[model samples]
Target: MEFPDGLVADTFARTWEMLLPSGTPGTAGLPARKLALAGPGLPDPGPAADIVLVPTHPQTGKAWQPPSGTAAVVPLSAEVWLHLAFPRDRLLVPATGGLPDGVLRDDPPPLHPAAPFRPDARIFFGTLARLPAVREPWLRTLHDHARHRFPHSFR
Candidate 1:
């Protein structure tokens, strides 16, 4: 079968509209050496690098992705996530209170094609495991002391 001689669907990169004036951490930049033709078309996938290739407006100096050609690169992440039975979304515990800096750790490049993961920590305090323990001291406790020693949740 033959199809129409035209583009069925088209997408352009405009991520530049969302980038900060000054680049933030975890952001990759489009290499400065590339010869870009400033016009409406997909962005050129500059040189390959482990970091992200954040495309920006040549004049505005902000993140932008042309909507048709460049196919701006949006790297997922260079960090490894923890491995546990808990859902990934449910365990959104970044080191800082905000995102892109939570419970994640900088992961070295993987030699194999697999998702980055770790077994550094896991939720072990469960209902059965928290049955007052086999033995305990009769002494009193302090604020959050019980909560820490015997967490009510695996969180």
Candidate 2:
């Protein structure tokens, strides 16, 4: 799928942050660590990214598996994409101000390894639009981004 330029621009404009689960070196337990997305000359005045995540390993307390001369791209599934996209601290409340019927309030789901992570603007906003809880400014933002980034894809 192709993304519109606007969406790509917005995505590149802001630094995306995610806390991901990692296997601790000595223990079986999984711990969360802060990961910052980076790429050379990213967040360009225009839209685009060659994204790579810089993660701090909890066990080593250091940068985990730094990318070589060129950053590695990882492919992720829609479910795993959603998990990383939304903010971890807040519950996703619809504009209606209540949980949609039948939607349950429970612990946030875990991220399954679908594939390696990659920064593709098209996939990112496409997945964002697919999320059920999205609304308002966010929805508009996604649409605008998609429209601007990949005009033909929508038509």
Candidate 3:
């Protein structure tokens, strides 16, 4: 099944909207880039790397099939890792209290196996692994802390 770039963007935007808080007060737009239309893929240097969007089923572990015709694989400055186990709700920022920035360095938060994770956490990262991007090491550190030390919640 082939979906247009706009359709994919709409789907992605809708999912994010449901996950984000209502009345959060932010202008909305979907960031979908055309892969072929975009320039050639270059080696990512530091912060200029592109992120991967791994599509998978939560229970079946089946990777999602991208819609046909002009699949827009937008290259991101930051990494975006997707897993069914990841919490898509509110994220915990550094100001959430109870955790220092260093706490995220050495271990996984503990509830990584669960869903609807920490309130201040912005994204889901795996304890032992992370998408290979420019910030790969840092993101892996954060994921380690999440899977080992923090709590997990569900909606």
Winner by lDDT: 2
Cα-based RMSD of the predictions, in order?
Answer: 25.0, 20.0, 19.7
lDDT of 1 at 104: 55
Report the lDDT tens digits of candidate 1 across residue range 61-101: 56544333343343211121111111133433454565453
Tens digits of lDDT, candidate 3, 22-96 = 312132222322221122131222222232243444556554433332332443222122222133433554455
Could you arrange the candidates by lDDT from highest to lowest?
Answer: 2, 3, 1
Ranking by TM-score: 2, 3, 1
Worst 10 residues of 3 by lDDT: 35-44
Cα lDDT of candidate 3 equals 0.34
Model 1 bad stretches (over 4 Å): 1-43, 46-52, 55-61, 66-72, 75-154
Residues 11-90 of candidate 2 have per-residue lDDT tens digits of 43232212111112112222222223332323321223233443343455444332342433333333333334433533
TM-score, prediction 3: 0.21
* Cα misplacement distance, residue 121 of candidate 1 (Å): 13
